[model samples]
Target: MSPEYAIEGAFSIKSDVYGFGVLMIEIVTGKKNRFFTHPDHNLNLLGHTWKSYNEDRLSELIDASILESSDQDEVFRVIAIGLLCVQQYPEDRPTMSSVMKMLTSNITLPRPKQPGFFTERKLEEADTSHSMLCLSSSNHSITTLAPR
Candidate 1:
């Protein structure tokens, strides 16, 4: 790995954890993980997911588009898992090892309280050439020369 990738690799496990969080959010909401807009709130899907989790109405974050096809228990579990990954403190978040255990095993995973806000994407100002210089868990991890 390049020095930049090496840096990101240092954080790779945590980054994968974050990606899992976004994936779970996408699965529950039937929306892309990036740039979601809700009618009532200006916050993106991550924000909405965080709000729903915090408000004890995480079920509300489930997308109406696929409601009937979803399993409520599994959905809730995934939501909780997502929130766990998105915790603001890296230490509070599960490592991929723990995440895999949480997903596959019957062990009782810790309850996830709530997720912090996901940083917004700012593609307009992004530099196409040097985008590969870094990897980021926040925003879209464009390979920009910006700090990872």
Candidate 2:
């Protein structure tokens, strides 16, 4: 879930764009977002991707299928666009039309900021014993809107 949806009860077209970014990552990595994990860094897929990108090790995040069959530059470009869509603030994300242009054209893209929900805690640090207690659960279902 996007951080805004999880923390603020907010939903909009930008939220769907965030989901699209996640979907792109899943396709490129051939991994499920829900089950993504890194034992050493205690990061899910998005966090790991950000870390890899910042460290100049994004090749480690690509699926073998893509690596063997796709152009590396194109793959990297798509990943960058995905990260842009999942920025922490909705306003920081590009519109869907902008995304299409980015995908199809060679225009320069803005550097992606850190994504939402990014975490770097160790596995031990993630244990519930040290976590804050919350009295209620946040709903994760996407609220649908009818056409105006």
TM-score of every candidate? 0.65, 0.80
Best model per lDDT = 2
RMSD, candidate 1, Å: 7.4
* Residues forming the 10-long window of minimal summed lDDT in candidate 2: 128-137
Which RMSD values do the candidates have, in order? Answer: 7.4, 6.9
**lDDT measured at residue 14 in model 1 versus the true structure, 0 to 100:** 65
Summing lDDT over every window of 10 consecutive residues in candidate 1, give the lowest-scoring window: 1-10
Q: Native-vs-model 2 lDDT? A: 0.84
lDDT of 1 by residue, 1-148 (tens): 1122244445544666766787877877888754466667556577778778778787777887656787777777788888888775566789888888887876877877545555444444233322543444467654557664
Tens digit of per-residue lDDT, candidate 2, span 71-92: 9999999999999988999999
